[model samples]
Target: MNKDEQLKAAINQKLIETGERERLKELLRAKLIECGWKDQLKAHCKEDFKHKNTLYMDKIMWTIMQFK
Candidate 1:
């Protein structure tokens, strides 16, 4: 299998063994959102070397992640 499929299979196997598939899925979704937000922020900040804006974006992203 490909790397993505292999990772999915491994995750599924672990969930089956632990019986926490639903909870794990939720956590994964939140993590994905956080990662996406981080990527977007980095892309935006690349053109503007503004540390304050980057810090603000990080804080906002973290707050949203917490609520998720």
Candidate 2:
């Protein structure tokens, strides 16, 4: 897979392995909020968390903004 795909897979793996799923989810929620993607992230997560594709757009957008 491509770099983006790889990264998403990694995040998915981490989220799965994380014992505190709710905490990690909360952390991610906060980060997304701090990164200005809270609304989109929340709406996307409300649908399903396993569907990484749903959050890819917002994740990528947040990443770009965070590093810029």
Candidate 3:
């Protein structure tokens, strides 16, 4: 892996081992909700999907996973 990728992997592993990953996720979720970004994103996504005839569940899930 490249240096940046290796550093990211190490940091992620450390976070996971220390149980900080879940805590960070919770904090991020709370911050997004507090800032109304979560609701705005949901509304924007819903609006985009409303115009589409085919909604791919996997693609939608992948997009959501990117946020997580």
Best by TM-score: 3
All candidates' lDDT scores?
Answer: 0.70, 0.69, 0.86
Off by over 4 Å in 1: 22-68
TM-score of each: 0.32, 0.30, 0.69
lDDT of 3 by residue, 1-68 (tens): 99999999999999999999999999999998999989887876786678779879997786666653
User: Which ranges in model 2 have alpha carbons more than 4 Å from their true place?
Assistant: 1-19, 39-68
Q: RMSD of each candidate?
A: 10.9, 11.6, 3.8
What number of clashing residue pairs does each candidate have, in the order they appear?
A: 0, 0, 0
Candidate 1 vs. true structure, TM-score: 0.32
Q: Write the per-residue lDDT of candidate 2 for residues 1-68, one digit (tens) a residue.
A: 99999999998888678766678778987897887776665555554545554557776566545542
| Model 1 lDDT tens row, 2-53 | 9999999998999889979988778887997778965665555553444454
User: lDDT of candidate 1?
Assistant: 0.70
lDDT value for candidate 3?
A: 0.86
Instruction: Give the worst 10-residue stretch by lDDT in candidate 3.
Output: 59-68
